[model samples]
Target: MARYWDDHTVYSQPSAEELRRKAKESASTAKKKGKNYSPIMPKSRRGEICTSWWGQAWCRNLESYADYSSRLDRGKGYVRSGTVIDLQIHDGKVLAKVQGRRRSPYNVEIRIGRLSEENCQKIIDKCSTRIESLEKLVSGEFPEELKEVFTSEGGLFPTVREISFGCSCPDWALMCKHVAAVMYGIGVRFDENPFYFFSLRGIDVDRFIGVALENRVEKMLQNAECKSDRIIDEDISSLFGVI
Candidate 1:
């Protein structure tokens, strides 16, 4: 794994092989011919936004992305917090990744202390009915103490603001524990319904696709219109001998 430095603290640790290679490179530079050569190995740069210790731990705990995703048979939830879903490279455009939990106190931790997916599934498999019942209770299907969490003044609804995101927790971070917990819970829900992930993030995948198509169409139309206008202007100027 690659590492990033932030505020005098190393967020991720390099893999064993990378560390070994770096050591060898440094040694080679030190044994040069005549001129003195600095023995420091150059660092190879990678992409921004990396998986933190917490995030990677969650994945390892969950078995793997494929297995975890398989549990979500399209009804419960999904991981929709980050802007980038997976690392994809395209032709010329390099879109900055929008997701991946960086190890920083400044951000919310959605899956910090959760059990690995494989282990959690074992528990659920052992007690499916009980787990389902708990889900319904917390969801407020019937009146109970859990209703407070989803009520307007209680939990589900929150105050909106233009300047600030309007989080009430005292963490002084971009997102509070509440936000992190919500995100983490959504990941668990994803084990039931993967489509629920986008819904939780307030994103309509279909609408996003439509918007992208419209943007491309508009760009093409603008290019065509400009070309036609230029041709017409040149023809008129030629006819009037004003070129």
Candidate 2:
């Protein structure tokens, strides 16, 4: 039941509920056709699109560098209305189904280039001494110095060239409203789980944390037997895997 359109097709947008119904029908059709049709709906229809430093930074990155800023207004409304019926994040790619005026949700795929080894190493080296814990990192509570490293040019954030997207909405513009909604939805996901950004960039969080802690850990272990050192709680030790 998905709809396809050419340049000549003009659409009178449908009600949000109608669009949602269409998306459900399409998912049903896909399931009948033996395709995976699981859809991830937005957690809320009436909250900020993004919150926290990392999430805001993601939205800003897309607006500041990408030409999609103009169409972002259209998408903000869609995303806030819960028109983004599904979104899936993966290493180097984001897949989504954005409900539109068409007969079904439009398919959206965004390709994000993996952060290069050199850039990743640079961030690790710059932040190794400053980051206090993995929890802080994932919660966007890291120090300002670390934030600078992440948002800096050629740093953790992606540039325009490192991103490419396509949507099945058939709009001739450079980026359609459906694509914009998905982009905002991506930011919302970051607010929910910041690690999604790392996964989207193909970065391993455990490896990054371990490498960053290597020198400090070695020093701590070396000094332990030479002098008296207080032991941490069992749960804390187990949580950090230091036991």
Candidate 2, 67-186: lDDT as tens digits: 677798888778776677778998889999887877667889999999989988887776565436544664555555467666897676788788899999768787888888888888
**Would you list the C-alpha lDDT of every candidate in the order shown?**
0.31, 0.75
For model 1, what is the alpha-carbon lDDT of residue 134?
A: 41
Best by lDDT: 2
**Which ranges of candidate 1 are over 4 A from the true structure?**
1-197, 228-243
Worst lDDT 10-window in candidate 2: 1-10
Model 1: per-residue Cα lDDT over 1-243, one tens digit each: 555734354345334344445434433443453423212111112221113322222223333324224332211111222211222112211111112222111222231122233433332232232334344433523223322322222122112221122223243445433343333333333333332322333334345334434554566677776646445544677888985
Tell me which residue pairs clash in candidate 2. none
TM-score of each: 0.20, 0.74
Model 1 pairs in collision: 61-116, 61-117, 62-117, 75-193, 76-193, 77-190, 78-197
TM match of model 1 to true structure: 0.20
- List residue ranges in candidate 2 displaced over 4 A: 1-9, 24-47, 131-135, 138-145, 218-243
Residue 63 Cα positional deviation in candidate 1, in Å, after optimal superposition: 26
